[model samples]
Target chain A: MAQQHLEPTDPTAGAPPKLSTAVEQGGPPTGDALAGYLRAQATEFLRALRLHRETGTASSVEESVDAARALRRSARRISGSLHTFRPLLDADWSEEMRPELAWLSGTLGLEHACEARLDRLLLALHRLSGSTPFPAQSLTSDSAGSGPPAPVTPERGNLTVGAAKAGALLERQLTLARTRAHSTALQALGSSRFHAVADKVAVLASEVPLTPAAPTTDLRALAAAAEDRLLAAAAALPLVTAGHPYNAEALVHGLSPDPAPHPQDGPWHQVRLLLRLHRYAREVLYGGGAPVDVRLLAAGQALNRHRDASEAAAAAASAARTPRIAPATAYALGVLHADQRHEVEAARFAFQQAWQKQTVGTP
Target chain B: MAQQHLEPTDPTAGAPPKLSTAVEQGGPPTGDALAGYLRAQATEFLRALRLHRETGTASSVEESVDAARALRRSARRISGSLHTFRPLLDADWSEEMRPELAWLSGTLGLEHACEARLDRLLLALHRLSGSTPFPAQSLTSDSAGSGPPAPVTPERGNLTVGAAKAGALLERQLTLARTRAHSTALQALGSSRFHAVADKVAVLASEVPLTPAAPTTDLRALAAAAEDRLLAAAAALPLVTAGHPYNAEALVHGLSPDPAPHPQDGPWHQVRLLLRLHRYAREVLYGGGAPVDVRLLAAGQALNRHRDASEAAAAAASAARTPRIAPATAYALGVLHADQRHEVEAARFAFQQAWQKQTVGTP
Candidate 1:
């Protein structure tokens, strides 16, 4: 049955396509196009799941990582598309499948997130403490003749006594966490719950249950609404503070002892969610084959950085809370936390630049 | 006349060596010990000043930079010692010489400070944006066979589009400022005021004018008072906040738009000044020939870093205020600002660690 649906000349393709065409041109609607979009995404997800399972033991670590990443991406797109275009899909099936897909995507993503966060913090520690020559000599006319200008070695930083200890502490804590996360992810992949999700996706690859009202729904309008939601959330962000080189208030707020997520981060996270839905809606409207929009890609990338930095800061903060640690270690962790927060601000600034430059409907 | 004082067995050394010995011992009054200490510091200053002048054009940039550093160090030591030991010296002479030494030190140090600051900010930007692999793979037993685990390439940071531009802006501004400082230092060195200061230092190399009460003054009590001042200032600092991994209040306080120096910073700065005086008093008590105290040196270095980080943060904030700049650039500068502020906190943490470990009068 899946092979039959995969054929180019399937009977469902004969219906007047409403979702994939311009909204202004009115035509007789059918559920075929929406079903086709969902089926294609589901098929890709199933393929990725198969590859991920295959690579678990047989392939190099990079290949395995890639497979997991692909699976997560496909799952996210399927889940997000279902969310933004929910009215046209069968209410119970779509609602049930959405959370499963979300769980799968999030579980699969934890290892990568942990790895990326550790990379960010260690790199920051090295740069902060390492001996790098000043690059400012380029401004001097005599710089060319002087070989390379001598490094401006400040009297005291030649040996940041705490840096090595701090790095070790961070490595020990984060590596332990990553190992635990890795095992959890592996267990999840081999579990009955995962098999159940895979089984559903396989069924979805050939059949998409749709509401009776699906045939008449205007997907363009729903997609436009997703874009509008993203825009509104972004507009509400503290853009002025983001533009300012230093947002002391945000920094102070981040320092609160409360273990909950930062309040200021909520709006940006909301924008990131809305953006994914908007991007996935576009994919559905274009029958999942349109050339990727460069601006949307840039904006999406920026938001992704925002999320990574926010998570990394949280990790640093957690590491700092380790009891009875050396004051030097705590100090290094503090610096690391601040570094990631700065990165958060930078990512927001990048998003503002990319999002503002975007023209609606151009893609 | 200066040659007589340069001799080891000069008339001043023949008196009961009161100031240079343990403060608990009672001894007959004499101004010779204090006079000898001042002359030795002055002689070193003169030598450094001469080296700085000679190295201005004939030496490599490194030599020139080193000469300036040496000159500034000597000038600072002399100026600080004079301030702390004011009662033993001719009031008029000490008062007049202190400001001249400060001016010379400030002018000479400006270029290097700018270079170090630029280095700090640029390094921070690169670390925040650069692609480095995750260091967490060490935790896994299988990591050795993976030919170095692949960099946990987070989807969006591969191209931090703003980093390059932000680095360029910082370089341009800081390099220009350094050049201006270099020229200003050179001009000041050649000015009549500097020449007058130099002539006075040269005369000081031969003779130090002493007050009538110098012979009776207890140098030990005065030096102890300087140490007391340093300890008092340190006690007033927010050590608890410094020890915490995240100092949100300090970070927020730093973000005030007011151009005045941060209020929290003022106490640290005061402590730095007191630390210097305390250190120089020890130098005087030892007749400037004692082995360096490792703990005191460590504490001093930490305070120096505190000063540098505070100034670097200020510079980043100033650059962010550049009118009509791109939001991305401002964001980068903002990140740089936060990075430096974290450094300031880290320095304070280091200072607390080092200072708390000191046993008074042990050195």
Candidate 2:
């Protein structure tokens, strides 16, 4: 029952194994095994996170980003393990994953890139012009130096920077191609894929593994089960909405819907169900949580970490001569200042609003 | 012998007239059934000559352009049918194959863009360079005409020209991906997929108007037979390549191996033995002839077509003044001219020399 309420796998429990896992596994193992393992895990991580996003249960960008970061961290750990695996292989394995993953990740990276660049561009353009606002100053001085475009820049970059504003149409062509391809692929994976994979994992967990197993089932079985659940979940997702499809190459397993309900009952019902199913099966086999959440509760602690981050940022800002930053940060700092001596007690309504609008939406 | 050759329910026979077949038949289609119907056939029109190439099988720049033309034709057919599917869907009837075919055709289009761009880039760049044979006077004048560093003839416009070069990369990527994903998926729906599907189709076809009657059989028995064949074929593939150890997705459906072979081999054989078994199966599938040789013959035809294309270009070049073209095209034209043709008269001698070299290990 304790397992029934939580994420089964407790993904946070993995924690990239803290670099120590690599140190501990500590082997100049054969190249074949290492490379294969690394490739498999990294690919799996991307697939899993892509699935998470497609579920669309998260209400905010922060939650989405948190999920992405968790997946990325797992992938990195998997990649780190590859360091050991690479030396074992007869041929370079990096190129193999790069081309394949790039086909998918390159597109996701493009979105990230656009977000980063747009943010930077906004930052550059938005700084106070000796003291005036945008468009008033966005126009070039047409002479020696152009004053800052806007008196007070917006906290983030504007989406209005079309190809003309960026540069010649020619310059933007390749970037557009690269970005569109990535964005399309990423969006597809996220919108419906999460449900698909969850569905798939659930199926495999319910079924008995074919191979002779010492630990009940092997890594292959685990992966196959996960893939099964994910694909099934993706398949069940309503296409009229968003997310990955039932038949994309990455999650190629046949989708079969779960006969049971998901655990947690979060935004993603399919994911909840499949995860629950897998957890149950895994527990039956290995005595772990039924429908394991895999360390997701660790993420619940992120709110605490965010508090620390806020304090650190406030201290740094207080020390700086230019205490004023963007309005967003200013607002954030204001909240931090009010937190002193529990001085923010009167803001219960505000806290509720923030939790509903921001925290729930984010991590 | 006929039973061995003919899939009991001939897919090409069209939907049977009335609901008789489905009432007699029962259940959904299997993977085996789906594959049996989709295998491409060779007819006398296509079989007149099966020319094969010795090396890489990728389509060239020109051939890819032609494929675009066919794709456009197919695209038109699909879009025209969309109205047919859309209206039917509104009527609560699923127009399954048409939509899927449409998507397949649409993805084929992305390949065309790559081809056209490659061709255009090559064309434009050639035009930028004067007519192929140089007028020595203009060459000198052009070299001396760099009056200003930035304008008139700057290479800025040419930077994006690399887009043409990237076209091949795009095409190659598409071919590799789509081929691995859909082609394999389609082919994987073999006797097992099809037999499963055949039951469904038999029912559906019987319900749908204007189709032939499905042959009678117990679906379970047929499905079991299909599974036997499916496993047999899937077993022939190397499920765990040294690098890709756990992906059963491709093998599970019998997509990895040549379909012409005895695709009934299950997952029991060692990868090496399975490969040999597939070859033997193919020979059995096609009386005494190897698919390897058939593919080779087809390639030779493509190469001959290319050779013919080059010959045509050379003849045109000989008849006309040097063309204004990209230096690349001029280079390509030169290459076309240099195509070493193996004439019928000396081919005998060349073969003897090659045979001798192989036997004696000559340089």
Instruction: Write model 1 residue lDDT over A1-363, tens digit each, in one string.
Output: 112212224334432342333222223223555676677777778777788788888788998888888888879987887888788888898888999999988888888888888877766666655334222223221211222222333122211322344456566667788888889989988999988988888988888887887866756677778888888888898887675433433444333334445567889999888888887776666553344569888988988988888888877666655544433334445555667776677687777777778875713
- Name the regions of candidate 2 deviating beyond 4 angstroms: A1-19, A25-51, A68-87, A90-96, A135-182, A187-363, B1-150, B153-363
Give every collision pair in model 1: A245-B334
Off by over 4 Å in 1: A1-31, A131-159, B1-363
lDDT of 2 at B289: 19
* Candidate 2, A1-363: lDDT as tens digits: 122222334444442332122223323212222223343444546565665566446467566655555554443434333222233222343334333332343444445444443333223223211112234223332112122343322212211111112211112333464468555855656555543533432332233122222222123243235436644663453322221111111111000011111111122334443433333223222222223232322222322322232322222123111112222222112112212101111111122223233211000
Candidate topping DockQ: 1
Residue-by-residue lDDT tens digits, candidate 1, B1-363: 112212234334332342343222224213555666667667777777778778887888888888788778878987887888888888998999999999999998899989998887766665554333222223221211212222333122211322444566667788999999999999998999999988888887778777877866767777778888888888888887775434433455333324344567888898888988887776666553344568888889989988988888877666655544433334345555667776777688778778778765623
lDDT of 1 at A91: 85
